[model samples]
Target: MAKPKILVTRRWPAVVEKRLSKSYNATLNPTDVAMASNAIATAFAKYDAICPTISDKLPAELFPQSRSRVRILGNYGVGFSHIDLDAAKAAGIVVTNTPGVLSECTADLVITLMLMVARRTSEGERQVRAGRWTGWRPTHMMGAKVSGATFGVLGFGRIGRSAAKRAHHGFGMKVIYYDAFPIAPDLAAESAAQSRDSIEAVLHEADAVSLHMPGGAENFHLINAERLALMKPTGILVNTARGEIIDGQALADALRSRTIAGAGLDVYEDEPTIPAALLQTNAVLLPHLGSATRATREAMGMMVADNLDAFFAGENLPNRVA
Candidate 1:
């Protein structure tokens, strides 16, 4: 039997390449860069599968261009917001993601963001770097306290539960959550998190709000002007999830006006181009780097490779996205 062809959208872990080369003709993207929709449509034509990241855009038009032999798409990241799902479905393609493996890494980053914002890590670093720091004063760079506060988690999932474990158990925070559906009773009981009726309810009640919802039409601009207004003037909002879920400009304006205290954002609507207005604010700005640990990157690559291996071998995928 002829070996299948693989189109790797970006350079992945070396280990994944070695395994893929064994069973499939793995071809790396010509450049270490994001491919345009037309480029992706053309390049994807020669392969049976393509592994894409959040940066890559797989448009609906590309589906029909792919050869009939193309069977699966092995996504390197967890979310599929970048892909046109309806197009992939119509083309009879299977989409798989690396879900459970990166949960802890992302969750840890969420907590890290919350801590950095709450504890004034970024400001202190800036102060020191700018050589403006003298001796510590009693009221120097004071911020919010996490202990004994209510932590409102939005969208309970693997990452959300992981974050809940840290906030509730490690910091003695009371965890309240808002999800469309009830989580498994056993899991909810184990996490010790209570569910809220609505997102507004969570916002109004939580001392800090951490978002974990997926990015899509339903969730786009979830934390808008009105929703963010519900937050306590002293509360913080942290998002390690998708960027478009929250309106960046609105949040920036809110921060400037002190609507909510501050925000810690890892992702953004126009990535690599944060709003000019947000540049000089108290917001803790980080490039989209939630699951950027070396160990986590390796695990994500391996999981994608494993999915590709299973699909090509006619086995059930461990993490199918569509």
Candidate 2:
């Protein structure tokens, strides 16, 4: 039988690329640049399976109106909001994502962001590098204290709970969360987290808020100007979740006016295209490094490989999302 032909949209880790190449007739993007939409559309006709990462935007229009030769979309990341599930389903495509492997690393980045923003580490590093740092004084670069503060979580999924535990156990902070579907009491007790009735309740009380929710139309701009107003003036916000959850312009305005103390973001509403207003603010921004660790990235790729293997063998997909 002929080997299954597959197209990887972006370059994966070296180990993953080697493993994938061994199993299937894989075409890897050597440049590591994002594939253009037209190229992706062509992939549908050429490859038996298309492996896509978050950077690839597979909308309804991208799917062929006629039947596509592609059978499965083995997504490299946990979040599938980038892929239009409705369109994939209509076109008889199965979509699978890698979820469990990335939870700890992503949560670690959340804490890293929270601490960097609260302690003003990014600003301090810039000052030192720019040759502007004077000797330390009692009032030099005063910043918020993360230890023993109230940490609020917007979503209590795997990553959210992991962050809550880090705040509570690692830093001696209080953890409170609000999830659409509350977790079990025992699971909540692990972090000693209390469930709030609404997102507003969590925002109003937390000293620092971390977002771990999914992104879609329902959560688009969910944390807008009005909701931001509910947060304490001393509060800081961190988002490792989808960027659309918070309005970039509103967050920039809040930072400029000192409505909130600071923000640390790993993800943005639009990837690689942050609002010009946000760049001018004191916010600490990162280029979506939530699961960038070597181990995590490899694990995510292996998970995708597992799903693809199962798919080709006509076995149950390990992480089918659609």
Give per-residue CA lDDT, model 2, range 167-285, as digits (tens): 99999999999999959999999999999999999999999999988998889999999989899999999999999999999999999988999899999888989999999988999
Worst 10-residue lDDT window for candidate 2 reads 59-68
Clashes in predicted model 1: 0
lDDT per model vs. reference: 0.86, 0.94
TM-score of each: 0.95, 0.99
Tens-place lDDT per residue, model 1, 1-322, is 8888888887777776677778688888656787677766765557788888988877786677433456788999898888888888887889999888889989998889999989989999988999999988999999999998998999999899899889998899999999998789887775689999999999999988999999877888989999989999988999999988998888988899999988899998767778888887779999988889888888998898889888988999999988
lDDT value for candidate 2?
0.94
Compute the lDDT for candidate 1: 0.86
TM-score of 2: 0.99
Question: Residue 183 in candidate 2 has what lDDT?
Answer: 93
